[model samples]
Target: MQNYTLLPEWAKQEAVILAWPHAGTDWAENLVNAQHTYVALINAVNRANAVVLLLCPQDEIDAATAALASNNQVLIVPSEYNDTWVRDYGFLTVSDNHKNYPISFTFNGWGQKFDATKDNQVNSSLAKLCQQPLIENSIVLEGGALEIDENQHLLSTASCLYNPKRNAYMTGDEYHTLFIECLGAKKVTIFNHGHLEGDDTDGHIDTLVRFTPLKGIVLQGADNRPHDPHFAELFKLQYEVSQALPTHKIYSLPLPLVLDDEGTRLPASYANYLIVNQHIIMPIYGQSEDKNALVIIQSAHPNYTIVPVLCHSLVQQNGSLHCVTMQVPTNTIKPEIIAKAQLGVSIL
Candidate 1:
């Protein structure tokens, strides 16, 4: 009878976990730009008075350390990983009786679109380093695919969680039951519509919708161009969210239409921002709408400081800031690791 409640992203955090980008992964074509984005993201999170646990491949540790100027708020550990998108493979922390427990779910590389054997094993290595026992589950889920509000209301997309490629064996009803039993979700709201073009996760809710600190929902609106393919679906999504959370205020962020060199639409989303401590690290794609998106998010979270990080390079890979990092809730890590993180000591 463990009363485990899924912690929201805005919960007081012990550390922000990130796996560094390297030449081994898809970022090899633009590794420098990707690393630069990571550096900017790390610096932004560090300034928020939150500890950072950075996992880097052994060969990239020196470069990453130098790039970050050896920031004391960061604890760099040498590790092996298939990719840098740790948000999907990292821990989804829960709390019970005021104590935090990190849950490690099975990540199948976003429905096996990518190689994830090593990515799936990252938490096992991290648990040993943090000296924190992981509450392991074989369920297929990703941190980026779900968002929890302060009231234990969980927001997710049916396209990702219910896709046959990801969980063909489980019905939507089964997932609803699992959410209640494991995450203590009082309400599970699944968005039937909403997706970003070029998104590889089928449809991660983080890329389209997010829960704001003001008890509101800030979701990505379709491109203003009516001819855009995402326009209609996003409109319906907005309506669905409004209906689902009638009591909560709804704020819509303009989705900037950004394309890669190949003319492929990159999933540039304002809703993919990360909330750490009292700061919100928002991803901006250097589009004209970037300023407006910032203003809208600020209105949604007036009490917090909004730190904008340029994510042009990140979106080129079809993801953004929140897709690359995972927050470690307070008390989730062992005291020793927290101590070392505070002292800016590399665990390895």
Candidate 2:
């Protein structure tokens, strides 16, 4: 099988894909608040990179377009989806010898925990819409579930990747094989522990650990509130990464105590930030941690602009900046780059 080199999120991108919230969807109640965050994101991203905003229920198009009418960088397109988590349903772009292609893997709505029939067709629809080459695969995966370094080493979690609901009967080695043969993974590491309390996506890696462009990790550190349910697991998270990247610089940001009035915890993590061309669109929950998150990211990438998008309502839907935005990487595979990469060489 020809390998597909996975591009890191920190690379230069043409556009950021966002599935906008609407009244006829699950975000109907939080529709106004959610759209506020989405609008902020669209505007921020458009300032530096193009914003691909996907709207459902055709009727909602005019209103969505009207909101961001000022920004010519915002591209509004009608779409059909089970929900608005496009990071999980959207296409993953990989470079095979410089030519870029979008990889479409089966999204089972976070382990088939939700409806994904329409959401599953998103990649093909998007490929036709963008006129990019689409590489279709039946492997169950999500854009938010894996982290790739500049070296193409994939960092993912065991709970989400190997769950029986996603890939039953397939051993861990078999799944690792898919990463190599399909996703262009030179190596694969499965972090076994640590998860958020109300997380439904089986501890997606984006919410747990983020790869810093500085060869470090921006991990979700536990707050002074030692009673947080996932405190013990967070310790394990730090230890696991320290063991993996010994020389890498690790930065820890405080976690917010964001739970619903009914006491349901929301999956809020500073590590779930979206890194675009020259901007870092981070998630803010109106907590003090929001400032620290911004400061830490800004310090790490002083060259890039840091934009914070209020995700209080979006977390109610169990996601944040990175969960909603997937970047479109530039296709740079030339003939020489492909020839070297084909024989187990680095494109970087």
Candidate 3:
């Protein structure tokens, strides 16, 4: 048996990968505001001494460099991408006997909802840049679609993993076997309940649930209003998680009810927070529940500092903070790769 294991997010990270927003992406409408959020996110990750592996298009290299102000712990790599949602396309790091292996899974633009030809090729460039031989897999898995605990329990939603658009040939048993073979998951829990309005990924687990370092699971709580559309579904989701992970302590984070300019509900979820080293970079909408959510998250992760960044603009695109970044586990990135990235070399 291969001694492989998918590292949890709380694991020490060598860097966090972020794709810079530009006129080419959906952020073209609000590029300035989105760039501001990216700048803040990069700086926040840097505070924990985690390097930021920033990917920018060749045309935006100078602009991205200027936006970052000081590139102290930031490494910029020029590349082409279809979108800024790196969490779905970036490499997923697995470990065996302390050795890091970066796996590249196929990304089909969220069930072919959008064009992802360029996004699918990102890991090839990243593999050469990081100097790590990529473990290529044909599984249609997204980083944000699954969460793993320290015990190797994999948590995800059935809506995504079982969707016919992504993987039509695989049965549940086949997927289970592949999870064990590729991701080293000791157990897999697929929740049928849980979803957010305006979510484009078809119920990605990151928008609904998460595994924390304290052996706790944080779920996105629905609004208190009984008539709210998500109340019943989220309530069932909480029950499902409790029954599934009976030993874990559960914490509820309030869901912020945010709407776009057209009065469309946006998926503003606190469950989409990113864990980087000793920090939990949380997404906060300018809502009344922001403070309460922070308190709850801090209590669950008492050792880590909670860094909140305004994600009002991010959710407008149907994702939040965690959707835009992917963490590179420690020992995976080489020093030479960092040096080359800092010089803003074109990886593509």
Candidate 4:
């Protein structure tokens, strides 16, 4: 169990981590397009903070280095990985009263669906890179499956964490106890209702609800339609859960009509937007609804500079802006501490 202190959205972050796309797994049919979009995302992130792009092999590192014209903005680390969803496998950082530490919740490839050997390695690698305490939790958790507020309360879904496929061994309360221990979260409230039919991780809550400062949630809402089985249950869940959690506000953002090509509906939703220090990187579908989604997100986050990232390629691969990258806070500790802390120390 790792005790986590939830950092605010406006916290000063150090850098963002991205796993360079592999051809077979994430890119398969659209390798070139994914790479281009990844580069663009790296470029956008570099404007505000440093970026670490995990290269699969030495050859890939060379190629990525060549592709990224501004090498200084990005660091190509040789790390093998199966998918580009680094947000799930990457380290989750928390700053204690004295020093900053990153907690690596053992990633089992979203419950062992894919190869996560390299993804797990990323945890210690990132810890080594940041020179901070890294607590490895025994329980299975993904960064994508959890959201926290300044008060250390967590927002999550029963669909993913409580799903039998992910953790059939543990009961709901048992799983939540691990969350409390790892995140130091006051409570782990379950969003029990909605299910995104297209979501693969049994409906990740990041695609349904997001916290905006001390205000409330910017949630995805859809009308009940006979053609869509998930709508009714989803709406009921949102309303009931919002009522249960009154302290936290909930704002419904309309869902963009499902995007499909060749009869296959992709995981396209506006709720998967990423929040950086100075900017809110949102996904756009290039549809008329894209404008409305942007306007809604902008209204919710008036303080941030909203950056619309064309995520058609990313969505096709079943992820978006927030899924592709993970942020690491900058360390300004003394040089002597950096050298001493690298060996090891009990963060608690």
Candidate 5:
């Protein structure tokens, strides 16, 4: 068996990766809006995270560089990708007992729903630029598909992973084997419930719930009011997690605005928050639900300063805060970081 184990996002980080939206992709008409969201995310992460890598396709490389010219806290790595969801196409860092390494897995456009030719080559470029070593694998996976906690338990949803177009041939037990084979996780928790309506990724766990540092979870819950249509399903999901992980704490966050733009409801989820160091970066939609979720999240994490980001435009493409950002674990080290960049490296 491999010695490396996958890590939770709440772990210490070196940097966060953001793939800038350009004029070439679907965000062409709303490129400005996408950038607006990214700016907030980049700025917030820069304060706590050491570096932010902005991936730009060749066509937009010059524009991206100029736009970020004043932001020295970030680095621009010229590359092409079908979309800006780096959390799905970017590197997957796994750590041996000694060090953390980026594991490269094939991303078939979340089961070929979209063109991924450009996105597929992202990690290869990153491996060369950051000089991050790659552990290539054939089992398809995305960074957004799973949410593991500090306890070595991998959490995910069956809707996305077990979809017919993705891995229909594999049994549930066999899929769990890949978690062990690839991530070194101790156990697997696959939820069949809890999903955002507009989420195109087929119930990605990030949009439904997240594992918190307090051995707790922040799940999307329905207020059971008349306006909340998915009350029953969300409530069932809460019970599923509560019963499954009985020893941990649980905080249910109210649903944010069923955010929409141009007649499409975006995946606005408070559960899709990012934690960096002692900071909690949450996406806010300026809805009544936003305030309640923040209070509950803050109560659960009194030690961290909660930073709410206005992500109205960010979700226009059906993904929100956590969907666009990929955290680099602090414990990882590339050969260049030590032998060349001289940033200091130590075996875990």
Candidate 6:
């Protein structure tokens, strides 16, 4: 396989794909809320781009169709999935300006901890739907573990991608070689992130730091309390690493005070906002810092509409907007071709 990296937002996309949640897994108890959230996401993203939704084989697509019936910016394709975390299992797209393909690396439910056999086929099916080549890498790779800059710089955490359980067959250097041959990442940009009590992915970059087009990166900060230890360690680690980056800029967003209900800490962070074509969608917990986070994100993305989705139930699942939604690059096919494809689907 040739080395490849993700195309920038400005790159052309064929369409955005999302896997709907099922009661079997990923949304066992929260299937209803996840469905509503999925609808809202479809509504929002369809404003600026075409959306292709993946549905379970035996599942009813009427709910999605009813919610989006008034809106003509979507297409629902029947597909099967074990979970709704498509960002990790969905295809990772790459292009070289002339040709484009969807990369389908092996997904082992983030190291076989979760049932993922069905989730693995998303890449091939998505590629077949798009009529593009499906690039398959035997190694286990999750989209959540990577953050890239336009300048070829990458950011990742050892706790998530480098976990021994995730890739016991490969060493660190061996993994780097795979990155070079598989994903055109120049080099792995590493940072030391401390563990948080409620964090399940062990420091996913989307929850810890995010790169902004204008203001650089807005990161989650824990500079005050020392009792949890992660407060001091994660805060310092984020600051030091940001200062070290020569080309990219950085800004710190205040981390929300951890929410706990009945002695359980919940994963909460303002960094989990999603970037659509014209809007930056975020989850709101009605906290005082919500305003602050919005202001910061708005200032960073001046051209985008700052959309806040009510995420009370979403946080209970330990992820926010970015964690749930994946952006498929638009303009992948030529404009004339896309226009023809659009004509095939009814305008209703």
Which candidate gets the maximum TM-score versus the true structure? 1
Clashes of each: 0, 5, 0, 4, 1, 8
Model 3 lDDT, residue 44, Cα: 89
Q: Which stretches of candidate 5 lie over 4 Å from their true place?
A: 69-71, 130-132, 224-227, 331-348
Clashes of 4: 4
Clashing pairs in 3: none
Off by over 4 Å in 6: 1-3, 9-14, 224-229, 258-263, 331-348
TM-score each candidate: 0.97, 0.92, 0.96, 0.88, 0.92, 0.87
Candidate 6 residues 60-172, lDDT tens each? Answer: 56655555545355555677777777767777767654456678777787667778898887666556555457778877878777777665556777788777767777777
Structural RMSD, model 3: 1.8
Candidate 2, residues 5-63, lDDT tens digits: the string is: 88998877766777768876788987888888887887777666444435445777777
- lDDT (Cα, 0-100) at 130 in candidate 1: 51
Angstrom error of the Cα, residue 12, model 6: value is 5.1
Q: Per-residue CA lDDT of candidate 1, range 7-64, in tens?
A: 9999998789999888888899999999899888988888887888999888888877
Question: Ranking by TM-score, best first?
Answer: 1, 3, 5, 2, 4, 6
lDDT of each: 0.87, 0.78, 0.87, 0.70, 0.79, 0.66
Q: Model 5 RMSD to the real structure?
A: 3.7
| Candidate 2 regions with alpha-carbon error over 4 angstroms | 332-348
What ranges in model 3 sit over 4 Å off?
Answer: 339-348
Tens-digit lDDT string for candidate 5 (157-202): 9889988887768889998988987888899999988777778898
